[model samples]
Target: MYQYDAYDQQLVDERVAQFRDQTRRFLAGELPEDEFRALRLRNGLYVQRFAPMLRVAIPYGLIAAKQMRMLAHIARRYDKGYGHFTTRQNIQYNWPKLEEVPDILADLASVQMHAIQTSGNCIRNVTSDHLAGVARDELLDPRPYCELTRQWSTFHPEFNWLPRKFKIAFSASQSDRAAVRVHDIGVQIVRNETGELGYRIYVGGGLGRMPMIGPLIKPFLPELDLLSYLEAVLRVYNRLGRRDNIHRARIKILVKDIKPEKFAELVEAEWAQLREGELKLRHADIEAMRQRFDQFTYDPAAAQDRSYAKHLEQDSAFASFAKRNVLAHRVDGYAVLFVSLKSPSGVPGDISAEQMEVVADLAERYSFGEVRATHDQNLVLADVQHKDLYTVWKTLREHELATPNIGLLTDMICCPGLDFCSLANASSISVAQDINDRFDALDHLHDIGELKLKMSGCMNGCGHHTVGHIGILGVDKHGEEWYQVTLGGSAGNDASLGDRTGPSFSRADIAEAVERIIDVYLEARDSEEESFLACYRRIGMAPFKARLYAEEAVEAA
Candidate 1:
């Protein structure tokens, strides 16, 4: 994790003081609602349907154990007893009072965390691979670059107030776990023939009403020109991106209208001027940023422990947990463990204060005092030793965090829907619960195999439904709740938007429709090893579409 220096501390403290005064003025009637709206949004506060929601940034999804404790404390003291982890790897409080926001910000600042740039039509949080430094296939550790980008863009006057919200993601692994293709700007760290490290930059990728897989703009960008190139892309979009209609304001719209080739040309022209300017990164600068992060000390003989194997052989429950929740690490002795928040009994991504506290304690005891939040709405202990696997699993199970459903159907990505979001057309949490109840059997979920089910309350695509193997979008049909389903979408290296089924289903039929879709998949698959995504890709949408709509067609006849 990157520790804050004096200057960083001063900047946050000063912003907290300023916001505190601003909040006070708004309540006192000195500040207008319209004016306060912008100020509060910059601080990541949103007035939801029922109450105020506060989104706190977990930069590149990394949080220290102490920071996790602070989050647990905030959840307990300020709002409801639980908080929701989002698809962007941030956390949200649904019931924070308006008057107490400044106090929350202050509490966050004490732990070197804040809600800055979490909302508004500005550059939002910069995200990267959750398995960045620890993944076995990673070509480079992207956290240093991510941190550098975060520092540069925090309050950059030129790019802060864009036409719409801007997102950037980085991935260094062979597998694109960061979903870089769906971001406004996606950077893939790669190596060329000469073994020189650089970036493969993609632009115009986004989801919403118009979903797109960002096209490759610059095939190979030099290591030293990272920031300069990014500035060029932003400059192009900031100048020509639409400002008339909110629907057409995103950079993706501009890229689409002008064509990707022309967008690339403009970026190149802009880069020709700024490539060697102040934004050009030097070797020393990169090294300094890398040095700021704390390095872990691995136990050399951790892999030699026999108790982990013994436990796996003796306990079926522990074995199942180890099989599903544990991941291979780049280091020989260490392992990455996922603490699932997707139990059938609760909302996806929602964790209680006590659960957060327990996770923090576990991180400190077993995983080098640090925890990571994943884009899939799960928490990670990235450096857990193999020797400590059983004890960690037992503790997590006791706290209701050890659900062995990492990439299963029940482990879905969902948004706060009509329950919390004012922009939602229908409820998503309840639908997720319905589907979970329908597919409660662990054997059934395991049989389905690696199905990424994502649901969003509306077209904002906050839940990333556009990229799920099975995507569910809540729709309002004549004041009634309905759902539209899509199939074969993915957020991996071979990214693609899903194709929609013929018609929307009533809330009552949505879960059954999902079940029918899975039934079709299981019957059509060549073997059990074939994943839902792979079978869907091979068989296409015709079979699933036919199965989903056949009953409706028959009833009409």
Candidate 2:
């Protein structure tokens, strides 16, 4: 919801102009395809297996209704009338022509959006909790910090051409909905005992060749010193992180080799030196940065002790929606509504142009004309009313947005594997559909309770399969589609990467394997309240492995 300042406006404007020139040269054959690929990728353009794909950053997954309208316009004017929301809280257009990208960037600039840092080896988009401003449990709204980092990292001279792409995420709330743990840098926003806002900084966490959880580089860094502390961490990483081998280039490899304690010591020494430098952000600047999140105007009339529960008591569909989709907002009257884009028999995060317009209209009409995209590949209305819950549900249902499957098995986070991605060996959308179709029984999924089934076609972990309660990764084995599974992974405060569960399954064997794993969970669980992750953790991998590998389970026992 942050509006772009003049400097922000000027920066994106200049970049867009520069990219236009680059694009013109590439089209004119002055630049070769390989040369253009690197240039364009740094600007968030990719040449997929078919056409070139352009990824547009939705910073921290926040979008205004006006921005949504802009996206719809982009879909209508440039793309194939739809946009695929990515797992990184970004949006991608798979069919973007190489020549049209600069024009697309121009349109995005008008809306205060861009693709900068959405790709490249430099610091990528700084993701945070999508429900930042609205989440009641948050220590502070994280967008200001994320925006600050965005400014500092964008075209940073030193780290601009790092060994590999670095991702950073901030989580301000009790829940780590942003999957901060799996990022290159994960900042857990916290308030000290003195009630001063600060960060618990984690460093060198990533997935790819080496999936390691970040270690706490700073247990508590004052909010004012966040930028300086971050600079220290990155400085250490840039100086020592490997460059000779692409596989060992990430900060994770450095963190692992240097040991977390030594890494922390180095960061501390660097911070001791530079903490007083020009980058030390002042309280006034923080407040100025904070003002942009003030776009939403609350309605006191829509406050609590309302009769909306009575309507839910009357209508079952509304009841289901109200129960599953709504979340607590910091404001008394406002509520956060998770509009499920992961509807039955649909793409996980693909919202059509009409759907986009409808949500945009709803946000403007009911909420505060503000929308958010979750890292979980869902849409959010950050300030819905308790009183207007049924009306919102009705509108969403009419637009086919009301799926009542938030946090359920069907609320899957998936990548556009094989369908759009050139690196993938198998189709993930079909795998997601198989699971959705099998558990189409909503009651059964609800009974299983809060199951996060994340899928990815490859080990890049875009879909965050490493952290899913039910993680499924697709691998190619001897030119055949094969699926690998992992369990007990979580991305919250107690974050840990899922361990691989051995032996890949055929495409035909995937659903059955999932069922077998679930069956083991059901049998081993202490109660229905115990989730798949909880059960798996409590009873180790032995039970689940037995069930998953059993001949009877493979043939449907």
Candidate 3:
């Protein structure tokens, strides 16, 4: 995690003071409700269905134990005793008083965290693989790039107010867990044949009412030109992106209207204006920023221990947890453990204050006091040692954090849809609960394999339904909740948007619909090794669509 430098510190401090003044004026009736609402939202404050919601930025999804404890304290002292971790790798508090939000901002600033750039028509949080520094397949640590971009984008004079909210994601890993394809700017970093690390930039990628996979504008962008290239991309989008209609204000709409080729050419032209000496990406700056992310350190000599194997074999429950929760680490003897908030019969990405405190404690005790939030809505203790796996699993299970379902169908990516979000047309949390309860068998979920069942409340695609292997989007038909399905979408190395299957189904019929799709996938698969995505890709949607729309699939049969 990048410790806040003096400039960063001063910037947040100033914003906190500014927000305090705004809070005073709003409470004093000096500012109108509408104006205050807009201003508050820009500061990550929202008036929710039942209360105010405040979103706090977790830069690149990295957090120190101290910061996590601060969040827990806030949840305990001010709002409800829990917070919702979002799919964008941020945390949201569902209940914060309007007048007290500034104090909350000040509290966040006390720990070097803030809620700035969290909402409203600006470049939002820059997210990357939560496993950025620890993942085995990573080419380069993208936290430095993400931090550099965050500094450049935060409060930029030109790009501050855009047609709509913009998002960017970066990945240095060979396998894309960050879902980079669905962001406005998806950056994939790679080393050249000669071993020079650079980025393969993807532009105009986004999911919402209109979803599209980003196009490769620069097949290989030298790291030195990373900032300049991004500047050029933003310049083009800000200049030409639609602003006349709120519904069609995203860069994806502009990209689709202009076609990807022309958009690429426009970015290229903009890049030609500001390349080389014209920009400011010196090696010293990169090194200075990179040093900030160099705080994490761990041991690498626990894998060969006889005690580790003995511990695993002794406890069957611990063994099950080790198999499901622990992940491969670049450092031998170390493992990355994913703590799933999406437990059976629970909210998808929520943690109570006690739960937060426990995770903070576990991070300090067993995982070096570092915790990360995944884009898939899970918490990660990135550097646990193999010898500590049993102890860690036991503690997590005691706290209800050990769910033994990392990448299963039950580990769903969901948004706070109509049940909570004012923008949603249908409920998401309820639907997710339905699916989880319906597919409670761990073996069946694990056996079905690699199924991403993403859901969004509506067409805004907050839940990223456009890219799920089996996407489900909630819709409202004559005041009733229904779901629209999409098939064959993926977000890894090869990205593709899902295609619509057929008509929407009632909320009561959705779990069955999903099961029918899974049933078809299970029957059509060549073997158990052929996962849902492979089967969907190999067979396409025709067969799945036939099964989904068939009357047999709609009924219990």
Model 2 ranges with Cα > 4 A deviation: 552-557
Q: How far is candidate 1 from the true structure (C-alpha RMSD, Å)?
A: 1.2
Of 2 and 3, which scores higher on lDDT?
3
TM-score of each: 0.99, 0.97, 0.97
Best by lDDT: 1
Write one digit per residue (lDDT tens) for candidate 2, span 1-557: 78888989999999999999998998899989888777898889987889988999988898888899999998888989889887788988888887889999999999999999788789998889988888888877889999999889998999888888899999888888777777889998898899888888888888765788888877899988988888888898888888899889999998889899998999999999999999999999999888866565577777754678789789987888877899888988677899998988689999888999999999998877888888888899888788877788888998889999999889988999988899887889999999888889878878888888889988777788888888888888778778888898888877888877878788887887887787788778998788888888889999888777767535321
lDDT of 1 by residue, 412-453 (tens): 999999999999998999999999999998888888888999
| lDDT for model 1 | 0.93
Q: List the candidate numbers ranked by lDDT, top first.
A: 1, 3, 2
> CA lDDT of 389 in candidate 2?
74
Candidate 3 local lDDT, 290-397, one digit each (tens): 998747555545757566789878887777777877888888888899998988867889898999998999898888788999988899999888778788788889
Candidate 1: the clashing residue pairs are none
Let me know the TM-score candidate 3 reaches against the reference structure: 0.97
lDDT against the true structure, each candidate = 0.93, 0.86, 0.87
